[model samples]
Each structure stands twice: as structure tokens, then as C-alpha cells.
Target: MKNASRLFLALIGLSLVVPVFADKDPNINAIKARQGEMQIRAHNLGPLIAMAKGKMPYEPKLAGQLAGNLKLLLDLDTSRDWPPGSDNKSYPHKTRALPNIWTSYPEIGKYGKDYATSVNELNAVAGDGLEALQSKIGAVGNTCKGCHDEYQEEHQH
Candidate 1:
């Protein structure tokens, strides 16, 4: 927790010190921005899943920290970064976001709301106990898969 706080503070300080420049290409920048956010989400989620699956022992402090970090992400205003024409069809190998994300309109909004709901539910119980965390995790996973199924481009392994 102390490490996370220090990192967060350092990032905030760095942002203030660093010179801000407009992106030469907003489309590529937008794609990178949103993908970075998703990567952050996945980074926090991996450990929770590992503990839930018994691949790692459930540590309440770490569980809470991870879940808390996810909850913090909910405050980000990333909608403006997801401009149309920034998907896989346009960026090719640069992104897996399908064009449908923009065309689907409110359909994608529903998925976002579902994801927020699931994340909130999970955060509420994550530090309570292993059983509590497990109970709400499937809903969160389902929300992610639901969105990916509808909008993300599939890659063959």
C-alpha cells in the first residue's frame, strides 16, 4: 500500500513536471491511452484471479489494495479518448478494438454500465473474505467477456 501511494504521488509529480504536448496523431494516441487503461485493469485483476483460483494464497491486504485500485480507475474519464476510426479496422495490428464499438452506440454503454456495476460489487466484498471475493468475481468476468465478445477483435492463437 505504501509503495502504491508513493508511485501514485510520483506519477502525479511527474505529470506536473513534464511538459504537455499535443499528440501528432490523436487517433494513435487515443488508442494507446485506452489500451493503457485496460492494461492497468488487467494488471490489478490477474492477482485477484490467481488468489481466487488458489494459485496463490489470498492475502486480505493485497486483495483490498488490488480491488481498491480497480475502484479508483472507475473515476477516469476516458470516453473522449475513444474516438471513432481508432479501431482495429483503422489501426490494424495496433489495436483489437472493433469498429462496432462506436457504431453500436448505447449497446456499448450498457456494457460499460454492467462493468461498472460488477466492479463496484466486487470491490465491496473483495477484502471481506476469500468466499466473498469469489462470489462476485464471476459477474465481473462476465461483464468483461460480454464487452469483448461484442466489440473486441479476436486473434487466432
Candidate 2:
């Protein structure tokens, strides 16, 4: 019985140590952070997209609030989230970021700047009226697509 208890305790200690080692991996943390940021952006944008598409009732105040939240998220400096070895090619199946992002840094930086501009536009007029929001949604989406097209790997069905 004492041996069994010691074995169980040893296994529990190993489990705790394993996660500590995993957390020390910068590549894993970078991928996780970027994925989390994308998830947050999606959460903030979902309702705005639905309203813009006429799938949801337009609420001007809510739209403004969501857009503001999205703008704040976009304004964050996420350079650390794309560190070396975090690309899809290096960490296959863990990230969708293409290696091209590092190679074509200037182009990707432009895309990021454009995305920030789109978010600013959305924040400016999201509360003005549905028409205004609808007008800018396409620009915001296009900015997203511009980066995704070149920097992200295509998803398989």
C-alpha cells in the first residue's frame, strides 16, 4: 500500500512538471497567444458581421461597443505573437501563419497597418447608423482577407 501511494504521488508530480516544461516552449506559447487573439477578434466581430449581413437586428449602441472592443484588440502590439519558429511550416498543425510572413515582412507589415486602419474606420462609424456600418464592413473584411490570403495556410475541408 505504501509503494502504491508513492507511485501515485510520483505520477502526480511528473504531471505537474510536464506542463511547466511545455510552458517554457516559446513557440508553443506564441502559437497559443496568436490563436487566442484570433478567437477574441472573431468573438467581437461575429455580431457586427451578422448585423451587417441583415442576419441580425441592428443595434447601434451594441455595434459601437463591439467595434470599440475590436479596435482595442487590434491596437495591441502583437509582434511577439509571430516570433521565429512559430510559423505553420515549423510547427505544422499548430499554427496557420505562413513562413512567408517572415520573408515578406514589409508586405505583411503593410497588411497589418491596413487592418488597423480598417478597424479605426469601423470604430468611427459603427455607431453612426446601420448604413455606415454596412459600408465599412466590407473594407474590414477585405483587410482581413488580404493578410489571410498571403500569410495563412488554407484550411482543408
Candidate 3:
């Protein structure tokens, strides 16, 4: 009887743990998708930022290509990557998206639209000249900062 009771308790414990582990994969995948998209945006924007800062020589053709790539990335519908379970409250350290994102849905959409507009403007003048690119770069950066400030949680490390 003692052995049976121990086995029953162990089975109950295992059952409780199993659902938690099962639910994690979808949340993990969503977080990864969000992170991956951000990484791609950074990759597309890195060269333009370097050129704008004079760290790299401004190549009009390359700048144009990068800007176009950025526009394409911005064009993606990213809402799907931000399901409720993917928020920091659900996944903790694995995701930086704050719970406020779900609550502030309208603001989030506005920010996304504003970012798309800024990127569109950048795409238009990317190959014009260094001066043109420099003028627009700050706006693009500001849009990113605005969204990040409101929607993303600060990283402690």
C-alpha cells in the first residue's frame, strides 16, 4: 500500500509538469520568431547606420538595396509573432515584449504604421546622396526608439 501511494504521488507530479513543458514550445517559438524578425531588421539597417555615422563610406547603390530590404522587412505583418502567450509576463526572460502591448493594441499598430512610413521615406531617398540618407536616418531611429520605449521591457543584462 505504501509503494502504491508513492507511485500515485509521483505520477500526479509528473502529470502536472508535463502540461507546463508542453505549453512552452509554442511560446518559445513565438518568442524566437519575434527575435528573429528584429535581428533581420537590424541586419538590414546596420550598414545604413554605419554609413550615416561615417563609419562606412556611403555607397548609393548599397544604401538603396539595404533600404529596400528594410522596407520589405517592415512590410511583413508582425502581429502574428506577438500572440498573448509570447509576452514577457508569460515567458519572462525569454521575451522582451511587455504585457502592455496587448493592452495598448491601437498604439502598437500606430507605431508600426509610423515605422513603415519612415522606412518608406528612407527607401525613396537612399540612393540620392549621403546628405539625404543622413537627414532621414534619425527619423527611422526615432520610430524604433519610440516603439521600443513603450512596448519592450528593459534588459537587466
What's the TM-score of every candidate structure?
0.84, 0.86, 0.82
- Against the reference, the lDDT scores of all candidates come to 0.89, 0.90, 0.88
Candidate 3 lDDT, 1-157, residue by residue in tens = 9999999999999999987656557767667878999998889888999999999999999999999998889767876678876788887878889989988777788888889899999999999999999999888989999999999998787
User: Arrange candidates by TM-score, highest first: which order?
Assistant: 2, 1, 3
* Least accurate 10 contiguous residues by lDDT in model 2: 18-27
lDDT of 2 by residue, 20-119 (tens): 6678778898889889999998898999999999999999999999999989997688888889768888888888989988887777889888999999
TM-score, structure 2 vs. true: 0.86
Backbone clash total for model 1 is 0
Question: Which of the predicted structures, 1 or 2, would earn the higher lDDT when compared with the native?
Answer: 2
Candidate 1, which segments miss by more than 4 Å at Cα? Answer: 1-20
- Write the number of the candidate with greater lDDT, choosing between 2 and 3: 2
lDDT of 1 by residue, 50-144 (tens): 98999999998899899889889999999877998898988899899998888877689989999999999999989999999999888888898
Q: Please list the residue runs of candidate 2 whose C-alpha ends up more than 4 Å from where it truly belongs after superposition.
A: 1-22
Clash pairs (backbone) in predicted model 2: none
